[model samples]
Target chain A: MSGPAYTPTDEELAHLQKLSSEFEPEVTGPLVGERQSSSAITTEYANADPVYRVKTAALPSKYSHYRTCRGDGHCGWRAIAFTYFEALLRLGDRNRFLEEETRLRSMGNLLNSIGFQEHLYEDFADECFDLLRKTESLVSAGNDERAAAELLASFNDVGVSMAIITYFKLLTSAWIQTHPNDFAPFLDLGQDIRQYCSTQIEPSVCEIDHVGMSALAEVLVKQAGFALEVLYLDRSAGEEINTYRFDPVSNDGLPLHNPPTLRLLYRPGHYDILYKMEDVQQPAIPQAPLHVALADYADEFVPMPTSRGMSDVMSLIPGMYPTGLGQNWPSVSYDYNPSPIPQPQMAAVPTYTSVPVPTTSQEYVNTAHHNVPLESPVGMSLNPPMTIERGGPFRPSMYELEPGFQSNHSQSLPFQTSIFRNSHYNTAHFLNPDFQPEEWSPDSEYVTGSRSRHKSASQ
Target chain B: MSSSRSQTPTKRLLNELQTYQSDPNDALVELGPVSDNELTHWTAVMKGVPGTAYEGGRWKLDIRIPSNYPNAPPEVKFVTRICHPNVNFKTGEICLDLLKTSWSPAYTITTTLTSIQQLLTSAEPDSPLNVDIAQLFRLGDFVGAEALIRYYTESERWEGRQSV
Candidate 1:
């Protein structure tokens, strides 16, 4: 017999409380899954509600790829953390990694300012920084694929990934505490910021909420000049997924034109990483070698035409042969001046020198002298008009010369023209596989006359 | 793989042990690994808060740390019977949220014990592990609760000492 008649009810309540506290939803999958085509999401929702089906079906066209974060309660935090590193890796810039590390390390002061014990938080912080340095080394070694694999592996390791999530949670907490005015209005009325963080942000099991996401984006993503975009896939009367974007702004308060972005797909409680088609492009390294090979092939096969008819026609152009007519035109061809006035001439010289001689009465008879085969019909049909537009005197041969010629010319004129400098084909371009940001050199600016000439050509 | 899995918690536990040794908390009487080879199993002796009914009594705690140590909160329960609303009298289970869902990697064993010490002074009667004790506090029977807490604190004080 129980001592009190009400004891049975109390026992039942206590048992239920214990059960609720210990209950964990069944979560199965890699902690952070491999990136896969987002069309898989459409397949997943195909049999579900029509709203989700429609939204998921439209997903891949916009967000081409996705990475799953296991549906454990920490999915939101893990998704953001995984995508932040991924966005950095997509940049393929070694110095960006170093800059991020320095920026994160400096936030230790923010952790300290919020009364977070340095020794206690440092373990989590160190795990994060160590991953950054590891990623930096991988990126510097030009092993992007391996670096990406290592990043995914680290995040999938429950211990390492959870440590990073915890560290981010702490940063978000500190950020909220430091900037209460921005976040306090979002909290329950009269609720203390510290109490809210302890209950909702710092807890390892707590899923990230809207306020926490904002704070995290502010401290982590936006400050690093990276944008955060979340696409909400909910049944809220819309055919399309609702998107919320937090864009990074420059110090002058203008939004950055196209900052590196970390994107997430939110399905109610769970979050997964989402990527656009451009986000998954391989670094430009492999294409460079192919271009070089094409250049070599063009150099071996193209006949240098010496047709007097072509020279006579070329002499008629105003800016052609700027050193005057009949003044060793071959020597003039070698001038390599990228000035706007001689660009037409330079374009003509490369066409005649590198392109197979087109079939003309004068050159057709002389074609046998070069010992190269005649142009194919396809090459003949495409070449003549392009050569004329490029201001060459000869009808363009079917064999296009630019691919090989540009690669060859690039070596001699490292920064060809403003257009070339701005193009993605330049090694200095961020999209290039070998992305190295152009650094200003005082010696090159002052010592080289050619550098100034190239600068003026850009204008 | 197993060794690497255990490495982080092991290293973290050692750092915590060193930190405690260098600057031990006033509320903690003793805290460390139960044996030299087993870093995961720890034992801590915590003094009750100075102004609480359980004052002058020392409570022994058994702490089982998971291999994923700071990422996962260490399991802590009292070894000595204590009279508190938020602590079980029959079994030594505690009802503090800090030891459960509110746990953060920033918490150390010493800090957790300090929180337990604080918990002794400020019991949450609404969510009680010891229903009778909670009923007394809810009914505002302060004198009766204090008498019961003091009686257990004195009687069960030496129950687990020899084992430690």
Candidate 2:
């Protein structure tokens, strides 16, 4: 069973002949000026051996099934030993397979019920059938030694590979080594089967590949069918016919094979002979952990009420809490005493202090504290805590004022005109671009956030 | 195991030339059926396997290649009635890798003819080739499949010559 006895067609021989001729003409380098053709790659290949030589040897009575049996040597002890070795290797893991099967069923993954187990049975049966075919041929040739205990050992190899799913590659490789031209074709089929299997099934260290399924799936169905077709055209075994067709690239099995996938080929609730032959060792993933009396952490996670422990927090910002700002960090007004209006607090801690209030309008505190002016809380400054004033003057330069209050406060506070003359303010560009007459007027109208509205109204 | 060959796609098809001298006494390997042909162009037939819904059913296929003989594989299609994942039932295009990607110089028209024959034999109703037949096959009434296969395989024999 190591290799199939094939009779190559005449067309196959001509293909090889064409290959030899294609490379022969350009083999040697020309003496001087011979124009070289672009297809001289074949010329480089000329020195190599001409391939596709058919080996004609009569195996002893052992190969009587194939008409190619020929014997020109001594006793066939070597062939007997090789055959026995193959048998022992094939069936070596039967005990392990049975043990594992029981283990998988105990865990409750019903692999024993699917078509996979039948596949295994089929592999074993096929091995037995092939060995029988070979043994019968040997017995017919009168080589009883080939039919002895040693001759059956070759099946051991088939058994091990079948259990782990390496049978197809081993068979393919044996075919390829003798027929090197078939290497490309073998690899192509191998890879196609691999992708197809790898698609539907996960990669396992020991699982037979998907190609085995492609080959075995059909075989199982046939043996299981046990019936023939009507209006049959013909039946023959001599022709080299491949009854299975699969795609290599586009025929990739479902893409979830390598990913985290659990393909229940069949639903739970059925178990039978077919399931026993399939791969039973699957990575077990449980639905939920068993309920043991473990300590519950829920009681420890109860948060302590720290805000209730504080006594001064309520007095610091006492106010009517704003009804609706719809913000997580909304802030209340800076007014110390309770106001008639329920204040909406700020969304976040202020980045800068509030602008200073004007001497006239009390509504202009510099929330965005800038270094521009000083307007101490009207004699009651001690009641509210504020930015500790930096040493300087009462003018806008002395007190820290926010830029928001710049327009109104700048007009009220006198500029440090003397400090400007001494410093870089002496530069001509730094001088007021529009030098309007500086006038003091209480007549300044109050217009908060609507100077344009007033002007447009007037217009 | 012995699967890949168990199922038989029922359906007989012969190209324009059925006179290739078939030896009836010799066991013949199953191959695809003829769907269409001329003097050189030819189609093949294969029957679906039993126990499956496509059992007793026939499938048609198209097989044509250049005169290069076995140097390149022929393009084979499941033309008659296909209701599996690997074939398009309506257009009769197939998705088997041996046809397109895995084709080698050694392959012949005969090999693909049989492989597709087995494919149609074991029709996976879960993976359908035709949207309509796939639906019908899904309900598990494989009898419909057998009827459809007969229609496609037999009706085409008349349509083929009439259309030409």
Which is the leading candidate under DockQ?
1
What are the per-residue Cα lDDT tens digits for candidate 1 across A1-459? Answer: 656654557879979997997888889999999888887898899889988876666666556689998999999999999889887787777777777887888888999999988877887777888888888899889898889989988887777788789999999999999999999999998999999999899987899999999999998888776789899999988566777889765554555544567989999989999886446656433211100111112322222232312332333222232221122111202111122243343245321211112222111111122222233343323222122234334434433433243333234354489888889988678999967556666555564667778889999
* Candidate 2 C-alpha lDDT tens digits along A160-271: 2132222222222222233344333534545543343332222111122233333332222111111111110112331111122221111122111111111111101110
Which CAPRI tier for candidate 2? incorrect
Task: Specify the highest-TM-score model's number.
Answer: 1
TM-score of predicted structure 2, chain A: 0.14
Model 1, residue A272: distance off in Å is: 0.7
Candidate 2 lDDT = 0.31
The alpha-carbon RMSD over the true interface for every model, in angstroms, is: 3.1, 12.6
Task: Report the number of backbone clashes for model 2.
Answer: 90
Considering only chain B, what TM-score does candidate 2 achieve? 0.54
Off by over 4 Å in 2: A1-459, B1-40, B48-52, B55-60, B67-71, B78-85, B124-128, B135-164
Off by over 4 Å in 1: A1-21, A283-459, B1-7, B159-164
Return the clash pairs for model 1, or none.
A284-A433, A379-A398, A384-A396
Candidate 2 RMSD to the correct structure: 32.0
